[model samples]
Target: MGPRVARCAILASAALFLYSCTFFEASVVPPGFAIVYGVSDYYPASPPISGDSYDLTYPDDDAIDMAALLVEQGFDVILRTNEDATMTQLELDFAEIGSRIEANGGSDTRFVFYFAGHGYGDGMDSVYGSSFPDAWDSYFDSESGASEPTGSGAFTEQLLLHDAMPINSISVQSVDDVLAVLDESLSDDELSDLLGTLPSSMQMVVIDACHSGGFRGSGTAADTIPESYEGWDEGVSVLDTLDAITLYLDYGSGLLDVGASDVGERQAIVISASGEQEFLYEGPVYGNGIFTHYLLQTPAEADRNFDGLVTANEAYAYARDQIVRVENEFFFGEGKFVPRVSGGAVDFVLFEAR
Candidate 1:
């Protein structure tokens, strides 16, 4: 079946309040173009991080396999791995693809961007009680009207490249510090510029790394949280609690707000392997990032309705369920690896089996 459009209206509310009520249009089986990147190597090529066990074992594999899966689904795919997966190359590719799509008059192209590598951010979610003690004091205390800060630090998430390196030399730094250095290689403004090249309004961005959800942005669904909620813990200050909840939902919601994009009728979905304040893990048993391992299973198991098509949401759901279940079983229910998706109101088919 050729691509078809679908309309969706959703009114979603949290236990405390309605975060969003949106009406959006979705598409199915649209003509697809994708760029997939995976980095299993890092800076200091002499000894090689991969050789030192600091490099990932399966991200390169993830990129190759994901590209294969997209090709099978009939998407025009570009795969970048290891040395080729650099910010400069990505910029060139983005510009080239954007030109091609623009040449077509910005048709309803389904654009997909996937990255499997080191990502920046603290992945500190207070809503779920996860926190970075150092950053917590400096980051949130300022808003909470606390006295002179004990810690002076902040955190945000960003995609990393192959040549990423440390920004500072802290004998013992937090996990967030490591992710941050890699992220500093690519600024958010630069990323936005790169994305601006793509003329398509319909897009799907998938990130598999620590704090991947931060890419979803925080202005949309996150602004829906109410200013007043009586459920605050007695021991916590209101500002502290609200800040935690807001940041968590902002980075973890997996929703992107493209309302301001110049492209008319814009709708973009972002799927992340972990929450903004979370880290992803891979093991030899799976031979891929846990999130990717399950996502690769989409073609075979994600068609929940068995309609011969697997929509983006369907694929996300299937992967998410499998991740949670498997992690719970293996970690005895202590697993916190949860994938997230953020987008406008529409969900589109990403794969078709006929």
Candidate 2:
């Protein structure tokens, strides 16, 4: 069956199950938690434009859709968009988030944050922006046709982290610039200490960007970076920066060793659209990026083993296989495009209430 049809079936089954349960006797599941942010346009000091303007649309849409799905599964979600908000507003929103977390009594809360927008990297850092201005310097001209910013730095993840919300999962549809900011945020030991301060829960981060190789333009979706960005290079990988941040925090404890399984105890999963040697592509149908499209369309039932849950590892495995199958069937039949997921095992439950 098509994805839409499969989704409908799942919804129907869920509704029936909930309806059949005794009203008062029914077990109450704690609500899932979420905070969503989407930035399409930028302000006066924005980054350079790339590809096409439409690239901004999909990530925001993905965030909304994800929020809707979470709501369907009984989550209490707060969504923010760039259209009617500003960066200062986002900061305030995050502060409120911290308050809410404290009020909710963090123990049972499972906070998730999602961002979809442009990302860039500096020589030693990566950044995520709401619009081209934040990601590229080329778009900073007075008459430049780029989106206006909401005053929030292109990267808002650190701000959120500073709010001390105790987030469990963070899914970012970052471009190269945003990744640079993430790297910078982690440059200090304070950020690492903040990460360490959180409860021992599963954490998941999903990034979609082009890093290397000739696979850059194979897809069909629009990009927000300018054609002039064809030669732009931030000089660092978001993953590597994250690793560095963690290493700095490890402080000779060897806790941040690469490929170490125990690291799963704290931060758990990272799903990247392409490998370190490949660049993620945007296709027409996929809208945002090929990897993200596959992730959203994946059927919950695909977790055939019925582990009562589908971890990030399982989701990535499924998405990788499917992305390859689709790519081969359509675009790059002669070439292979494989998405990747790093870190260790993470709990990513799908059929559970909330």
- Whole-model lDDT, model 2: 0.42
Tens digits of per-residue lDDT, candidate 2, 1-354, equal 699999999999999899876463633344355566554443323323342232244655666776676677665667765453344554555566556665664645455544444433222122222322323333222222222111101211222211111111121223444443343222112222333343424334454444211112111111222212322334556654654465455534655432221112244344545533333455677555566666665546346566344556666677777866666455442134565544322355432411
Clashes of each: 7, 42
Worst 10 residues of 1 by lDDT: 145-154
lDDT of 1 by residue, 68-166 (tens): 999988888889998898877887788777777766547677788889988754324343354333443334344442211111112345667877763
Most lDDT-accurate candidate? 1
Can you give the lDDT of residue 123 in candidate 2? 20
Candidate 1: regions farther than 4 A off: 1-28, 45-52, 122-154, 166-184, 187-189, 219-267, 332-335
